[model samples]
Target: MTGSLQPVLAGVVTALVGFASSFTVVLAGLRAVGATDTQASSGLLAVCVLSGASAVWLGLRHRLPISIAWSTPGAALLVATGPVAGGWPAAVGAFVVSGLLIVAAGLFPPLSRAVAAIPKPIAAAMLAGVLLPLCTAPVRALVEVPALAGPVVLVWLLLHRYARRWAVPGALAVAVVAIALTAPPARPGSAGLWPVLDPTVPSLSLSALVGLAVPLFLVTMAAQNVPGMAVLTGYGYRPPFGSALRVTGLASAVAAPVGGHAVNLAAITAALAAGPDAHPDPDRRWIASVTAGVGLALLGLGAGVATTLVLLSPPVLIEAVAGLALVGALAGALAAALAEPDAREAAVVTFVVTAAGVSLLGVGGAFWGLLAGGLMLLLFRRPRPATAPAPEDGGTVAGAATPRQPGRRPGRRGVPAGR
Candidate 1:
């Protein structure tokens, strides 16, 4: 009995951390795009339910740990772009387009290849740019509302130095308690005080389609889903990327009417549930991810309670917590963007352009930055040299690499006889 507890504990913590750390971002993103209070809460609820169900289904079907999450980068993209010209309805249309693109990427090899062909540095730069401004909310809240923000920052800093995984959760716990103590009685208007699906008929507009739809699809795939697959691979689980994308895309489409943007594989928290710490036996770790999915759905159903609690504080407090939550991701993106000298200049160009929040020709900065960076890479960087084969590779490498030079004699086409 005691032996089984570790996986369960890890699973619960993974779910808790995933929710507490990012839900505020999702809510803020919804509102940024002009989601009404009901619509925003509804979107949050739908995404939670869909994410949990997908995670459990994938975990059970593959017998592998798969933790699903809302697209944090997509949320940041929304934050950076602000509300579209036509408001929330148009944004919902773009959300639907993004989901369809995900589905297409999975179903069509060429589409998937196109997404894969995006340079890693450019993608990393765009993500870092999206996250940079969001990660500064803690500083703003500290200056604006020190009494409220000070304690949250202190607890976060202490826990970050000690128990890194628990840092954001600890800060969130303190915020919840503090808010509850100082908060006024429950408000009269919240989405029915329970999870309810309030669907909106989507309206398509050119600006929303180009600015929000395409970039949302790109960022969700590049920053979250792709790396999430890599993270699962790092944990020794080779996911069938095609099927994973397809299912999650379908889930996203189903949830979009209610404001859910994108639901995809989780990279950061996936490690928490997929790694050895979740369970000694690798085969049994799926339980943790499955448990996480169940936990996410439960949290979704109870979102009203948590939402009410969070709303009591000034909205900046929520942003502060969210900013703190995203600090690690921002750091990672920046590091990856500049990791190689060849791409460093191009990556910096991408980061600066995207962060500058420049929009042109009805397209957002993310797409332009990526386009500019890719162009720079093509012009400046040399193609990588072909790799040499290991000693064990035998004749396959010889045939591919040596291919009998045009003037060489047949008897000694490839390498010197003895040297």
Candidate 2:
């Protein structure tokens, strides 16, 4: 019973950590794109519900925590370019295009196979690169507001060293406590449950279609969905690609309007939920995602209340907690990406570039990190065959050693044995 209880606790913690870290970024992105209070909450709710449902559904079917989310890169692209072209409408259209591209990639096995073939180390490097900025945000905020951010940072460091698994929850608890200790009061506002229909209608514009839509599409496909699927596969789960894709696409289509821009597979957050510490069985860990989804939906439905809670914390406090929560995931990804032999070079390229935080032609560093690493692999490396040569014969060895073809047998070369 103690052993069983351990697994359950681990699973719950995994879900909590993954949910907390992933949602912070999503909320930040939504805010960056000008989502109103209700809209932002609703959009976050959509991410929670969809990500959890996908995780549960995939876990039940293939037994894995395949928690998905909106692509951070997509959001970065949106904030960088969506506003420049046509504002929210352009963002919505970009999401639609990106979702469709992801759907299309899932439907095409060749593309999936190609993405799957990328070296794991390189993927990890790219992931590390992409998440580095996110990880640093809290510290930067701390410099801005020490009174609130300082305590959270101190506790986070303590938990990270002594109670590794509790790191995220501990940091979050400290932030909540600090907020409770000293927060400015807020009065009731006119913002309510009203929905906006403006973002629902897609507007066709050359600037948005070329700049925002194209980059968003590419990022969702190469940077988000591809690595997400790899995380599931690495954990020995074969989630039905089509079902997950459809859910991500549908979620984005639904949320694109009212200021939600994009949703796809989560890489860093998904890793937190999919690893062994999450659950020993891996079959039941979907509970975490399920629970998170419910929480997210509630947050969306009660956007006002949720906003009140978020607003209660000093901005730096929230940022610090969010950054602290990601420390474990960042460490794990870096370790994994650097551990492999064949993937070392590719991974290094990815990590440095992604962490560089460069943006070019409306694309974020995440997308470019993957692109550069993949190109390096293609240009310099050959695929390592799964089997080696047979000892007696030159023929390749497979599942098991087979008798060499009569004519090709080493001992019988150039002549039939009995003739």
lDDT of 1 by residue, 109-217 (tens): 6786687667667888888888877888999999988888899999999999999888998998888877777777655446556877789999998988988899899
**In model 2, where do residues sit more than 4 Å from their true spots?**
1-15, 56-66, 69-83, 116-129, 187-200, 204-236, 261-303, 328-419
What lDDT tens digits, residue by residue, belong to model 2 across residues 120-237? Answer: 6676676566556667878787788787777778877898789765666677777777777777545433344332222356665566566556556655655566566555555555
Quote the positional error of residue 319 for candidate 1 in Å: 0.9
Against the true structure, what is each candidate's TM-score? 0.88, 0.68
Model 1: what TM-score?
Answer: 0.88
In model 1, state the lDDT of residue 38.
80
> What lDDT score is found at residue 100 in candidate 2?
69
Candidates' C-alpha lDDT:
0.80, 0.57
